[model samples]
Target: MAQARQLEQEQGQGSFVQSVKSELFSPEKRQGNLNIALSLSVFAGAIVFLRNFGELLAV
Candidate 1:
């Protein structure tokens, strides 16, 4: 009986992990992640441009 309970718990844990992995790598999540990365890159580029502009003005 104890072995059966342990096996059930192990199977449940495995399925739970698989479900989480699927959710993490789903298409919608990937798109959202890509959008976030693109936005961050754009933001960084803008900051760099502004800094360069400020240096030019200082000189």
Candidate 2:
């Protein structure tokens, strides 16, 4: 059972890496991925800014 679990984990990791490589090489997906990363960073930055602003007001 342990051996089977290890094999399964290795296979899962390999597939994950393969999928990432495919996405990275595909031009169509590149833009979508960049947009997603940009949006997530902006959202996080906004949250941090808001938290600091609130703290400043409290002081």
Candidate 3:
């Protein structure tokens, strides 16, 4: 009985992982991921620029 329960749990986990993988890599999700990446890049760049500007002001 314990072995059967363990096997069932394993199969359930496998299906859950597959579902998550499918959702993550779907075309619609890819576009959203790209937008997120671009936004993060722009935000990081702005922060770096502001820090440099502040240092220059301090000097």
Best TM-score among the predictions, by candidate number: 2
lDDT of 1 by residue, 1-59 (tens): 99999999999999999989887788868888788889999999999998878677675
Q: Please write out the lDDT profile of model 3 over residues 1-59, one tens digit for every residue.
A: 99999999999999999999887788879988789899999999989998878667675
Q: In candidate 2, which residue ranges exceed 4 Å CA deviation?
A: 1-12, 55-59
Clashing pairs in 2: none
TM-score to true structure, per model = 0.49, 0.62, 0.54
Better of 2 and 3 by TM-score: 2
C-alpha local distance difference test of each model? 0.89, 0.91, 0.90
TM-score for predicted model 2 compared with the true structure: 0.62
Q: Please report, as a residue range, the 10-residue window in candidate 1 with the lowest summed lDDT.
A: 50-59
lDDT of 3 at 46: 89
